[model samples]
Target chain A: MCAMTSAQRVFTTLSHQEPDRVPLALNLVLRGARELGLSIRDYFSDPANVVEAQLRLQQRFRSDVLFGFFHAALEYEAWGGEVVFTEDGPPNSGAPVLGSHQPLSSLRLPELAASKGLLKVLQAIEAMKARVGDEVPILGVAVSPYSLPVLQLGFDRYIELLLGDRAEFWTLMEQNIAFCQSWANAQLAAGASAIVYFDPLASPTLVPRSLYQDTGFQVAQRTFAGLKGPTVTLLASGRSLGVLDDLAATGTLGVGVSCDEDLAQIKAACRGRLCVIGNLNGLAMVDWSPAEAERQVKAALAQAGPGGGFILCDTHGEIPWWVPDDTLMALGEAVQTWGRYPLVGAEAHA
Target chain B: MEARTLRFEAALLSMDRVLCRSLLQEAMGEERQLEGIEHLLGPALAHIGDRWEAGELALTQVYMGGRICEDLLADLCPTSSTPVAGGPRIGVGVLLDQHQLGKRIVASSLRSCGFQVLDYGQGLEPLELARLARKDQVPILMVSVLMLNSALRLRELREALGEGPERPRLVVGGAPFRFNPRLWQEVGADAVGQTGVDAVAIAQRLLEESCAP
Candidate 1:
């Protein structure tokens, strides 16, 4: 095969066909903030700074995808929720909208153009697209309708409502789907090539496998189905094994698993069905030497790369601010170096 | 694990504070809240945590369980005039973890177990822990380490805790401690516990050791 653009390589790999090399999609948020002398607070405040930092990281690493920037509290803030901003970390959803007994119909997906925090995100998407055009695929980030509730209503509180008040819970899910549709449309219109939706609640650590399939899957399926571009879903670091088939059932083109999952099993499960994009232990990438991190990436590639349909990325959606730039760069280098397809005879490949 | 306990667990799962308090009162009949916790509530909460881990329950359910335990402890724990043998004045809080529901449960359980636990809240810096220990003259300091940031700062926290004849004994617990049993030792802690009951046992022993003539 001839040389491929990162987009083509990603497209090819997701199709269960080998490209010249494996594709890489790095989710840079706090990791980039630290490098640019921008605090998490500063990063959330400026669209230009975010795009500039993204381009700098892209130029340095030449990764295949730039997972879009998110302010973490955008939706909560959009819903008039108070977000607690700290100098050292991401903002916390201080007071949940549903902190008290708010009726389910009270939830609203307001016009993005009317909301400042969310509007900034839409503008940032446009900025990244205007700057990087076709250089790399930009993945507009959207919290899955299921996972997004944890922001507006705290995780524990929301789950309480779900279990205790089924009527209100479904209403909340309906609101989420409605919100996601418009939010994703804004991103798609702003030039995001794809939507990377994250819904950690579907993972085994939060909801039962049966519960996720029955409720979480439906919420996600509708949310992903409405997306204007290709979709990739992220599962938080939890017991996700029980829900793989359910995840595949959502009809996302690809799935992002945590670093803790076994790759071989996911590949077998996703075989010729879904693109498998992960399992590089985020901690190992943060703590290990570059060479060790590279080896770890190669090890993940050996299992996830062979038959194609794999992308190299940190299993965690966010890397620690302390994770070194060299370590981040090393991931791209390893994929380009050792992630070639058509695995040779065992001894030679090793 | 009993049907009665299961009923309590179910009520707690739905965030029913009234029913939970009633069930807890029944379970505690004539026993210390610590005893009830160790025997009844603790196991129930642990089971909820298991379900949460197994995907049978949500983290929200676990948090709601913690809240129910907290509300019950408000009535059940502080009223125990009959003090236990190992009761001591100790300071307790989580280090660097905003998820204080687990720590709150641990602190409440310790209070019921007869320790006078200082509620330092979560997001405590190592320096604050040292100051609280020294200022309060607490002989046994219990700090919960759950986040990686807290774990990384353990060595510094140990040094910041200072050295003196009245130096508080450091007893560690939480997932980070369970993740590495030897972590407490690395942080220069006197002991570590895998559970709230174990934490009380370890704290008592450490307190007794600190008081050794």
Candidate 2:
């Protein structure tokens, strides 16, 4: 097998084609930055720092794709929510603006392209693209419309509105979809080759499967359908596997699975259709030894990597301040060593 | 039958299904307040957390149910329940990087157990929280930091209180503390509550202990 660049390997795997080896992809975000010893606050506040962090992250993981923004708060921050910045932790909302039983009509949805922090994100994308457009696949991260509404109107209120009024909920989703389309289009125009929609809150662990399918999944489908770039929809919790087929049908290039889902099951469900990008236990990287990390990564590769359509990554973003550096590095090294393809026969097709 | 049994049944049912919708509705009020529900809201939530921790519920069930409870608490600001006359005001908030559920429940439990409770919500800066405690004239400040990193901020809150004679007694709790017992002293908290029931008892003990001198 010939040597291939990390970007070439990752995009090839994502495209369901053979690469030199299975790609080691880090879903780089604010949390991963802290794990990598960079400052999350500094990254967002300074454009130069953002550029440095992106390059360092790409170098460290030898990642196939480059993620532009770090957290999901930018969209909410742009949609009239006050983001409470932490010293080194992920930023959270100041206070929820929408109330229970509050009519969705009372809220004014902002135009996605004109939101504040979004421009900063777009600028980051432009900077990253300008810097590494030819070297890496610049993947822009966007919050799903269903999850965006949770950010705009606090999660509780958003879920209530979703459960109580379908028409109004979908209208809100339509607005969010419009925002995502414009936001994604802007990022793509700025040089993003693909987009990853992070929808952690939409997990079946948070909402019932029926509600997720009816509201979250549908909104996600519409949002992905509107995106111009190749898209990866990340279902961040394992509880969403029962609906993996529905998720796969959303027209995304692949479905990102969380650690809780059975790898074999997801591989089987996603076979012949969309590719599978993750399912490694992220918390294990925090507490496990390097040897243990390698062992687990090898096991995950054995289960999910043999085929051409798999990309290796954590089930979720790295937890800040807890995960050890060596464990993360071990994961990357393990993927490089053990994730090669052309398995000796019958198992190769699997 | 006993009230505990009834409470247990109500708690189990709430954890399983009933209370989530109403709680979500209550938290997300029609206009978006999401703050005041943490008083009685805490016990209701604790009952659910207890069930989950005790293996009576699955993680997914606990999360989905907990999200509903948290959503409700997040919507309502702390409101006085028949304002305690001459009762020492107690302010409750989560340390930076910590989610507010367990802290909110502790605050709610404190109120039901007869302490004057003020829920400051989640991810508060140590200095800001200390300032709020001083401004509110709270005699007891209950802090909850769920994440290990945030647990260190309790010490910051203590330093912010300084040598002031009016400093409120501090109580801390959460998962990080459960993992690291030494955090109670490391964070400089006067007392630490391991559970919601224990938190209420600690508040009562502190009130009595402070009144003795």
Candidate 3:
């Protein structure tokens, strides 16, 4: 096997082609920075600071892929949702400017290029592309329609409306899907090689399978259809494993499994069609020692690596802010050292 | 058995109805509203929680059953009524390090149970919350942090409010407290609620206890 760019490794794995080694996709953001003795507030507000932090992360971990940005609020900010920006922290979504009872005719979705936070994200993407686009695959993150609703209405209001009204729900879904489609396409146009659609709120843990099918599925289907590049859909919560096959059918390049899903079950459900990009516990990385982090990463590799369709990553999102820098480094080192092909089967390891 | 069954059945039907409403309202938003959830959902969940604590129901059964209840709640109850009081309001929010579900649930439940709940939503900063607390002259500051790291913000908020003549009472909750009960003390919360209902009860109790003096 030869060394491959993280983009090549991820794209190849998604295509089910053999890669030099399993790609390690680091969702580096606030938490990753905290581990490195950097401030989360400082990185997000300053584009240059973000680049410096990301470059530092890449230098420290030598991860297969170096990804930037954190949280799914960027598109929300662009889509008429107000963001209450914190000086040294991730931004919070303000109350929805548009209420549910308001006629669908009232809300016209914003063009992706014209949105607020999106330009910053685009600028970051362009900056990253200029610097490292050739060396690594740049993944642009966007919120799924289902998640966008959560941001716009606030999680509580969104969930309530979902329970209370069905017809209007589908309508909202359509509108959000259109919004995400345009947003994702713009990112791809701006030089993002891949788009990661994060539906953090669409976890089966919160919504039933039937509701997910009825409401979230179609929006996801349409959003993925609008994307020009390889796309990854992250069903961020673990309880969605029961609907893994349903998610895989969205025609995404891969599905990001949460820490709670069994690797074997996800792989079985994916059936070599979609790649799998997770199962390592993000919370553990926050608190575990370096040796422990390495051990967990190695264990994940043993379970998820073999057969070329796995991209090692934290089950969902970035490492939390409290994790030690050494632990994160060890995780990267473990993936680099032990994530080679022909993974020793779990039974053999036992 | 009959009363329990009646409440359970009412709860189940109510949960189903709420779930139906939530599914229909999926377009409205994602936040769990307490006003819509209070009537049947709250009592049912309280019943379920009590039953589980008494060993009358299994954890798996409660979890599975609660998820069914939550799914209904998620759809039906989305958003709390904006706090009505004209006093200094403490704008409580979830730390970026934590999940907002538990906090939102508690905030809404508190609102219905009669506290002026200013839900700052999820992934909020401690300084912002503290600023809101000061601006609102919020008598009680409740911060719900599920992750241990996010819990550190409570201490930061406390420091921000340090030695103030009008510092509000601080309350904290969520899963992290289950293992490390001392986190409430460490984070400088005056009290901590173990569950949503307990949160309401604790807040009320704290208020009552304070007012009595």
DockQ of each: 0.31, 0.10, 0.10
State the TM-score for model 2.
0.70
| Best-first order by lDDT | 1, 2, 3
Task: Encode model 3's per-residue lDDT on B160-186: one tens digit a residue.
Answer: 866654777888876556434566787
Two-way TM-score contest, 1 vs 2, winner:
1
lDDT of 1: 0.71
Regions of candidate 2 where Cα sits further than 4 Å from its true position:
A15-18, A28-42, A46-48, A97-106, A236-238, A280-289, A318-324, A342-350, B1-92, B97-118, B127-213
TM-score of chain B of each: 0.67, 0.65, 0.65
Error of 1 at A17 (Å): 2.6
State residue A133's C-alpha deviation in candidate 3, in Å. 4.5
| Model 3 DockQ class | incorrect
lDDT of 3 by residue, A1-350 (tens): 67777777777888876687778877666654454455554556656666666767766776666564655666666767666544344555555656656654576788765765677677777777888867788788888888777656655556657777888777888888888777777778877888888875455645656667777777788778777877787766344565676687777778788665678777767758878888777654555788787777777777767777888887765655555778878877877777766565322442
TM-score-sorted candidate list, best first: 1, 3, 2
How much of the true A–B contact set does each candidate keep? Answer: 0.33, 0.04, 0.02
For candidate 3, give the lDDT of residue A65: 65
Best-fitting candidate, scored by lDDT: 1
After superposition, the stretches of candidate 3 with alpha carbons farther than 4 Å from their true spots are: A31-49, A68-71, A99-106, A133-135, A345-350, B1-43, B46-101, B107-142, B146-150, B157-171, B174-213
Lowest summed lDDT window (length 10), candidate 2 chain A:
A341-350
